[model samples]
Target: MKPQSMLFTIYGEYVRHYGGEIWVGSLTRLMGEFGLSEQAVRAAISRMLKQGWLVSRKVGNRGYYAMSPRGQKRLDEAAARIYRQDSQVWNGTWCMVSYNIPEERRQLRDQLRKELSWMGFGMLSTSTWISPNDLADRVREITVTYEITDYVEIFNCQHLGWSHPGDLVEKCWNIDEMNQAYQEFIEIYRPQYEDILQKIQNGQEIPDNYCFVEKTKLVHEYRKFLFIDPDFPKELLPDVWLAADADQLFQDYYTLLNPCANRFFDSVYEPCPLVEANEVNS
Candidate 1:
């Protein structure tokens, strides 16, 4: 895994639970389990800091890092989607965003598209995106963040269309491809989950560090769905969906590994002291 991506997984799965911050040394040590060099970890952290995803604080000579408000909001949203048990009930309304950003701000336009896609909006056209989810607040935030409010328009309306809603879904997204990916996930992890369950049933003692590694890897792999899975509402999904099955397996396997994993993590985790907000550096 790339150092930065792995760091995000670690932060989302581990560090966020323990006070939402970590010492740089502790970060490097935890990353060491994945064979990442300290230099690589530091460089990734630096890049994240520059990207406004991290804020730093200094206590004496030691430095600590935590997610900024933007980062925290993003991770919170991701966690909600990741652990959601049921598909949202669609109100038969689609949230559509249409934009005509200037060519001079091409970078902003690209970033907006990426953000929209990440939020489960599918591109209906080169300049228009749609999602079944109600995302007015999220869209507003993105437009403000990119300073493109004037170029963007948001609407919540029923699809009184010439084409069926399902056809629009197909046109905007590759549901078959996403379903196939979920099937692959189930095939790979089901056996591992069964093996571990059997081991537990036989009263076999698993190592704490081993559980930690397994849990982290499991979460890392499962969290990829956050990017690829738009998590469409149940009414919009196919009759047979493997994403739900995959989600259940992930939850079970994660629960099975959590205690030992947390124990191992606590052994290596070093907590940082809280400082006043103004005293911290961004």
Candidate 2:
């Protein structure tokens, strides 16, 4: 992973629990497991600060990094989707966005499209996007951000005449490819799952360093889904969805690894209020 991406992955998985702050030494040491040099890690941190995703503070002679309020808000929004367990209760309604931008505003148009996709809207045509979830507020935010409220329209409607909802899903998303990716993830991480389970059953504790390294790796692997999968509702997904299985596996492994990983973090950084490991299962 790129150092910046790895940095965010680390924050989302571990650092957020510590009030979204960590000493530079601890951050660099943790990132070292990913084969990133301390210099590279520092550079990445600098970039993040410049991008307003992180803020730096000095205490005595030690330097620490904290997520900016903007960064914290983004992470909080992502957590809702990443950790959501129950299937969405789809109301059989679809939200659509249609836009026509002038050539002079093509850059803003591109930005709008990207933001829409991140909000789980899939393109149905060159100028149209759709989602199962209500996206009025999200669309309002996007339009306000891009100053394109006059160029776009949002609608909530149900499919009636031509193509089936299933067909529309297939056209908008590459479910087959996503399924294969989930299968690949299972192949790669299934052994780690079994090994961790065996160790737990034997009443053996994972070493602090190894636990830290593996936990980072686990989060890195799973976080890729945030970009690649829009995480559509189960009712919209195929009959044999591998993503569901993958999510369950992630939950089980993450729950088991939490205690050991926290031990390693406490060694490197000053501990704050602890979030109970069992909270994940809840």
lDDT winner: 1
Could you tell me the lDDT of residue 127 within candidate 1? 99
lDDT of 1 at 256: 97
lDDT of 2 by residue, 1-282 (tens): 799988887788778987788878888888886689999999999999998899876655567788888788767767777887686678888999999999999999998988887777778999998888887787887698679999999899898858777788888877788898999989888889899899889998778778777777877887777666777876788887898889888888888787888888778875333445542210
TM-score of each: 0.95, 0.88
For candidate 1, write residues 1-282 as lDDT tens digits.
Answer: 888888888888888998889999988988888889999999999999999999998775688889889988888888888888676567899999999999999999999998998898988999999999899889998899888999999999889878788788989998888899899999999999999999999999999988988898998888888877788887788777799899999999999999999999999998976566556453
- Model 1 CA deviation exceeding 4 Å by range: 274-282
Give me the displacement of residue 210 in model 2, in angstroms.
Answer: 1.5
RMSD (Å) per prediction: 1.8, 6.2
